[model samples]
Target: MNQTYHVYILASARNGTLYTGVTGDLAQRMWQHRNGKGAKFASKYGVHRLVHAEAFTNVNDAIAREKAIKKWRRAWKLELIERGNPQWLDLYDRLNG
Candidate 1:
């Protein structure tokens, strides 16, 4: 079986703090973030709203994408999220629903 990995972006709100990460389980990771059990930066900044995500079959690819996004300018990152999620919705509920 092929395992899936995801590169995801979370935000405190529209035009608020942003976070990028890679995970094999997006839903579980989102759960962790929502509950304040994920990355220290996420918890510290209250960055728990899922704004964007991309899936990959390879973990390395996902990690690479995550790194690339992390290096992006804030405007670029916001554009990325706005392109797909203009409302900046919390996608975590969609993951499980």
Candidate 2:
């Protein structure tokens, strides 16, 4: 069966510290981050807000995208997020709705 992967960026707040990651399940990953059970960096930096997410059918592509985003300049990352999420809203709720 085909699978979906996600490349996501989490932030502490608008323009705050950021965390980039790739996951097969966005909602579950975000839940872990929110509950301080995800990445150490994210929990330690309070970066649990899902600011941006991109879907991919291929896991390798998603991983590559995550790696690329992680190396992006802060301004570039913000621009990417703002293009899709102008207000930098937490997208976790949207996942359920």
Candidate 3:
């Protein structure tokens, strides 16, 4: 089966701390973040709300996007998230449900 990769952003709250990452399983990754078992930066800042995500069939593309976003200015990153999630909603429940 073909695997999907995702570049995702997590936030502590609306307009709060942010974390960017790439994952093969978004659902599982979000679970780890929520449980305090994901990236140390995220856990340390309580950045567990899924605010933005993009899926790619190619892992390389996903990784590239993730790296690019990680390097983006905070305002740019916020704009990216707000374009799709203006409310900065936690997308975790939406992904699972």
Candidate 4:
């Protein structure tokens, strides 16, 4: 079976600032974010780390998930990031490599 997922996240440089987004290609999308070429939010806010992501079976579910996460509070978002990416590493390299 082929499953598709849409995810949302908050990215910041070293400490704070959050950026939310959804993407079908997580690895490539994250690479662009890290390189400062993915989105204006990332470049402007220096949110270049893969702090959070979620997988969905459909794009609609992904969009829904993204919107849901976007509404979460900063602390909740931080917990979300830590849940999947405790160290807050750029998961793009591992996926691409």
Write one digit per residue (lDDT tens) for candidate 1, span 1-97.
8999999999998999999999999999999998989999999999999999999998989998999999999999999999999988888889978
* 41-87: candidate 3 lDDT, tens digit per residue: 99999999999999999999999899999899999999999999998
lDDT to native, each model: 0.94, 0.94, 0.93, 0.76
Residue range with the least summed lDDT across 10 consecutive positions in model 2: 65-74
- The worst-scoring run of ten residues by lDDT in candidate 3 lies at 88-97
Off by over 4 Å in 3: none
RMSD of 2: 0.7
Using Cα atoms with residue i matched to residue i, what is each candidate's TM-score against the true structure?
0.97, 0.97, 0.97, 0.81
- The ten-residue window of minimal lDDT in model 4 covers 6-15
Clashing pairs in 3: none
**Global lDDT of model 3:** 0.93
Give the per-residue lDDT digits (tens) of candidate 4, residues 49-72. Answer: 666667777888888878888888
Give model 2's TM-score versus the native structure.
0.97
- RMSD value for candidate 3: 0.7
